[model samples]
Target chain A: MIVAERKPFDEIKNMVSGYKKVLTVGCGTCVAVCLAGGSKEVETLNAELNLAFGKDKIEFGAETVERQCDMEFLAELDAKADEYDALISMACGAGIQFLAERFPNKPVFPAVNTSFIGVNLDVGWYEEKCRACGTCVLGLTGGICPVTLCAKSLFNGPCGGTNQKSCEIDKDQPCAWYKIHERLAGQDRLGQIIEISPPNDWSNQKPRKVIQPGYEERVKALGR
Target chain B: MKSGSNLEKILKAGHFAFTGEVGPPRGANVEALREKVSYLKGNVDMANITDNQTAMVRMSSWAASIICMQEGVEPNFQMVCRDRNRLAMQADILGAYAHGIRNMLCLSGDHQQFGDHPQSKGVFDLDSMQLIGMVKKMRDEGKFLGGADIDGPPELFIGAAANPFAEPFEWRVHRLAKKVAAGADFVQTQCVFNMERIRAWVAQANDMGLTDKVAILPGITPMKSVGMAKYMKNKVPGMDVPDEIIKRLQGVDKKNVADEGIKIACEQIEEFKEMKGVAGVHLMAIEWEHKVPEIAERAGVLPRPEV
Candidate 1:
């Protein structure tokens, strides 16, 4: 899931300081799962902002959508768009961008920092699982993402800093290459890591867009 | 005679090559580096200028290598994949080469958490092995990492680090073999305190014929005191300091611990000299550079070859 964390309190306060009426929009998807932004988080932020502003000079409200990325769910906010001076988006980068695109006139501020696509390790613990590099090599590395796990993002093998199966950088973290080696060795597929990977093609170009081929044809046929 | 660097010449001539390390100053001050280089002059074959070794910011190894060259000391330029991408790495390699640096050591470097700035993002675009391969390609093929032509290729004697003491110990020699296959001309290992493990690793390398493929230089850092010994043994990851050595240090008087450390280091050097497939010794005195001359002299690596 696309994980995110709330921006610092001071930064969020500064972003909404001049606004007299503000709406805090939360996403019930990845941000909620990561405990960064959800309906409860939005209420907490709204209450905090009200207390920080004091004197009731600014009115704060909170709302949450099923998924901020979906245009249908975003339609729920269109009815109250003109009632608020500013909108605070407690969603990932993609969500904030989508929200901004929906309400082009109103100022949209992001309340959280989109971190990475990761998985929940335990309660309150999240580990990055993918870089969205657009090139997948998990089949080669026994399903471990070296591009995101290895500190050096090494594709070939482990570096000299692998100590006791842990990373030399952060002793608490297991060395990604070490884990890959162990997994491949256990599976009797050690030859995969030994083979040098060609340089990444970097196909994840910026602002890239893709449309489902059959969906485009279906849309054209259904056109009124 | 790769790059014809003094270290390479000494190693090629079958002499016990001695290489010293010099950490670049945090600021732009070159006087400290110059003094260290001058102090190490004639006492060692090459002076390795570290590249922000533990991730603490310092004068770049590329600039320090040039400074060392100015001080009449050939430099073994150390580069880590932590700070630069492939483009920056290839550019710096050419820059170092233009500055007359011949020997290059590729390392993955200590994590940023160990350095002063733990928050900085690491740029490990390529690991040490890939870095070695890239350097090899640039030098041998006269092309950049992306396979673009260079006006003049850098003639480099590539070096890679090995930690025989690191865990999954069985794979250490095979890792060294991979580095050699990737174009590492020589291999300098992590500091050696466990001689039995090092001997076993060397034997494994010999069995794999890796010893003949690349020159293996074991790293040695003389402990300054019992505290230093404990830190390396316990705190430093992958460092294997045997109990007997700690006991030996603990047996000595507080003031005599430094000398005891030197004595132990000298013994290790002597053992390395006799070990099969061992090429030389890389003496890392840490901040105790003044004692390197004494350690080298005591280890009979003095009167460095004038090649």
Candidate 2:
């Protein structure tokens, strides 16, 4: 899921300080689960902002939709969003950009910073899982992604930096190659580790439009 | 006579080649660098100029290699994949070659977090293997990584590093073989205090015929003191300082600890000389460069074979 954290109050305050009437729009999806832009979080932020501004400094209202990135949910905001001088989006970066595009005339500001595509480790805890490097080598590396975990993104073998299964960068960070070696060894698949991996093609990093396999023709037909 | 380096000549002559390491000073103190280089001059066939070792900022290897050359000492210039992209890597090779550097060692440098600048960005566009392959491509095929032509290719005697004592012990020999296959002409193993493990690793490499494919130089570091031994054992990444060696260091008197360390290093060198598939010894007397000559002499590798 897309993990995000709320921006510091000072920065958020500064962003909406100029507006007399502001609506805090929160997403009900990824950011909500991460506790950044859910309805409860939006209400808490609004209450805090109300306390800081007293009643006269700024007028604050809060609303949350099923998903802010989707146009259908954004259409709901479009109906009542016209009265506000500005908007504070408590969603992932994609949601903030879509909200801005939907209400282009109004000033749309982000209330949270979208971090990475990650898995929720525990309540309010997250760890990055993938870098979207386009080409995946997980199958070749015993399910560990060296592209994301290895500090140098080394492909051939572990560098001389693997010490006691820890990375040279931080003792807490496990060495990706060491883990790969262990996993491959456990599966009796260590022979493949010696095979040389050619340099990755970074051309896959260019902004891509990936259409779901079977829906490509239908999408193309519906497109301009 | 690839690159025609003196080290290459000595190894090719079937003599046990000797090499020392010189870490460039943090600042551009050319005089200090010259003094350090002088310590290894004429004592070893070649001296390796380290590239930002420990990820600490220092004078670059190529620049120090020039200084070593000017001081009548041959340099085995080191390059790490941590700092440069492929473009910069190829450019540095051409530039360093123009400066008369003949020997080059490819490495995946120590992470930046281990250095003074912990927050620095890591630009490992290529690992050491890829770097070795790229160097070979430029040298043999006379082409750039982009498959474009090079006006003049750098004829370098390529070297790579290995840590036989590192984790997943069974993979160590195969790792070295992969490096040899990557176009490395020679290899220097990580500092070896675990003699038994290094011995086994080398034997495995011999079985795989890596000795015929590439020159293997077992690395030796003469610890300065018991504290240094403990640091290398406990703190340094990829190091395997056996407890018995540490016990030996602890057995010595405080004043005699350094001598004991030198003794241990010299013994390792003698053993490596007798071991099959062992092409040479790379002595890294860190910050104790002046003692390399003594170590080389006591180890009976001196007079440098006149190659």
Top candidate on TM-score is: 2
Candidate 1 residue spans exceeding 4 A from truth: A8-10, A51-56, A122-124, A202-205, A212-224
Residue B130 in candidate 1, Cα distance off native in Å: 1.3
Q: Which ranges of candidate 2 are over 4 A from the true structure?
A: A212-224
Docking class of 1: medium
Candidate 2 clashes between residue pairs 3 or more apart in a chain or in different chains:
none
| Model 1 Cα lDDT, one tens digit per residue, A38-125 | 9989988888888899737888888999999998999999998789989999999999999999999999999999999999999779
lDDT of 2 by residue, B1-307 (tens): 7788888888888999888899988999999999998888889888899999988999988998999999988999999988888988899999999989999999999988888888988887888888999999999999998899999899999999999988788888888988888899989989999999998998999899889989999999998898999998888888898899989999989999999999999888889889999999898888999988788889998687786
lDDT of 1 by residue, B31-135 (tens): 877887877888889988999988899999999999998988888999998899888999999999998899999998887878999999887767788889999
Native contacts retained, all candidates in order: 0.56, 0.81
Against the reference, the lDDT scores of all candidates come to 0.88, 0.90
Tell me each candidate's TM-score: 0.93, 0.94
